[model samples]
Target: MPSTDFQESSSSPSSFNLSILSRRRDQVHSMDSPPLESNGQQSDLEAFQRTVAERFQDLAAAPSEELLSIPWIRKLLDTFLCVHEEFRLIVFNHKSSLAKPPMDKYITDFFERSVKALDVCNAIRDGIEQIRHWQKQLEIVLCALDNQRSIGEGQFRRAKKALIDLTIAMLDERDSNTTVSHRNRSFGRQSNSRAEPRSMANFRSLSWSVSRTWSAARQLQAISSNLAPPRGNEISATNGLNVGVFTMSYVLLFVMWALVAAIPCQDRGLPTHLFTRQFAWAAPIGSLYERIMEESKRRDRRNTCGLMREIYEIEKCVRLMNELTDCVEFPLTEERERQVKQRVQEIGKIYEAIKEGLDPLERLVREVFRRIVRSRTEGLDSIARANLQD
Candidate 1:
């Protein structure tokens, strides 16, 4: 019954536009699910990348006035293990004492801060010691807790033994006392029957009250045994938890320090330009430093290889992402930002991969390092002497 002229044609652009919008929404939803790159691993990588990259840029863009001391909170418990952590502080900590060289990239504060006794490594040294020192302190507290629990247990045992002795004495007293009381009652009953004796009820009631008192004492003892004491096992258990804290904190730091010490690569310093130049000369991978990095990434480690691998993977991804950003002269934009975001995701993936890979590597690295360090030091010293003689 509809008029043909009034009917809107299905082929027209207006009707077709609604179909397109629905399709677009569906497309976005498909991308919205976690990426297969590692669920959200890639995203985490991208986030880390952006943070570091932005910090780098900020440092670069900072005015001479602003660049004096980095505002970043460098509370890296992990950073203390870095090969360059102590060195960088040592180099920068002396900024104020240097000859009138004003071409220094140091924010004036860096030099000013460095003047007091030149203990650039002091902070890192303190941090490392504290991590271990706190561990030892935790161990002491745990020992104290354990000792306290032992004393408490000794007290409980003593109480239980005393209760047993008291119960046995009470039972013996009751048995002998009952015999005596029974005899007396019998005599009294006989005397009462002969005299005015229908009133034995009061004595019988007193006997019942004594029996009830004995039952109550027994119940009280049972309840005391069953109820939990205020500090039973708790102190020891807390001390037990300290064992975990010690292990976790020590293991993480040990793994971190071992990584820095054993690795062939060094941080050199924050002189990115100077390093970049040296790195450029190291090999032609556009950066000589990059080539040494690739070589170092492939090094042999005993058990801790996995840990090293994980660290290296994160390091590699970071290096690559930084390199990409550096080479890109393009202006930052939404699309570029999205690309950066993708890089962050990759970094996250690398982080997880490294973590997953740490345990085996740690064991192997320690064993091998101990042997190598033991044997190589004297030989290396002799070789240096020989080279000097030559």
Candidate 2:
């Protein structure tokens, strides 16, 4: 039951914290008063660190059976969006200082990293569509076998054909490097010919889908490249704002990496070396990463389309059902009939899980995509205004 809404509640503690931060920011901007105390700034930065550490700790503490499941992934996105909102507010409070030398560079770099993540979001949406396609095939199998008084060769043949189609579709997804753009899919609203000529509008137009050769693994590498922690001197110079920027950068990288890990994407790869032990959030993030990587390396999980628990279940049930059908005789013994029903029952359960979870998960991803777009657009605008006033 993780909350999926992107907006923070007005009565929430974070909202109260934001109001306090806003008042502090206003005081610092007053021409009649001296600058705000450094202690106030330090405390704000500390709160941000603690919030991130606590959220990821909760995620990492999930039981092994629940880890990487659909609900778990939804919770992970919820964490990212919450932390991201807090980070966005922190940047707003410090906007006057953002146009300065090193802080400017740090903020600019974080935006660049965020831009890369937009592509990841689009790729993930396509990946979700890919799963939906597989779901349709599962539904076909269910229709062929479910609710029958007694199983027959015709029913078995129909179910087997759907299973075979599902197998081929999944294998093609894992092996094919072709652009998913050909599917004409996107999470964004339909572009209007008369819309404003804004940068974000143009960005949406061009990036509604990934290019033919676009690789999720390579995009992740681009985001992680040169993403080192801010040094002590840099932190001192930026009044610890650099640390926030770096923290958001790493969060962006890790979240996108986890999405690619859980969903089918072009050229999927997990780069384990991107994480570091320097931050409090690192341990939980790293723990989750290791668990997923181990899951990927499992004998049965190898060559699979994704590491999602539902996807794994689907594969297992399909295989068992397929095997049972292949060994069927025209006159099914009572025990053999029971076994077929058991296999069908297993598939039915998985089908129900996918049916219930897939739409909600896709909606969460769409929210993630929209939140990233809105944040980036607002941030870049804020930076431009800051530069102008300076």
Best candidate, TM-score: 2
lDDT of all predictions, in order shown? 0.28, 0.74
The TM-score measured for candidate 2 stands at 0.82
lDDT, candidate 1, equals 0.28
Root-mean-square deviation of each candidate, in angstroms?
Answer: 37.7, 10.8
Model 2 clashing residue pairs (backbone): none
- Give the clash count for each candidate: 32, 0
Q: In angstroms, how far off is 159's CA in candidate 1?
A: 63
**Residue-level lDDT tens digits of model 1 in 111-217:** 22222111212222222222232223223322322223122334333433433333332222223222322222100111111221223234233432233122221
lDDT of 2 by residue, 247-299 (tens): 88888898998888888777677445667766666666767777777777788
- lDDT, model 1, position 138: 25
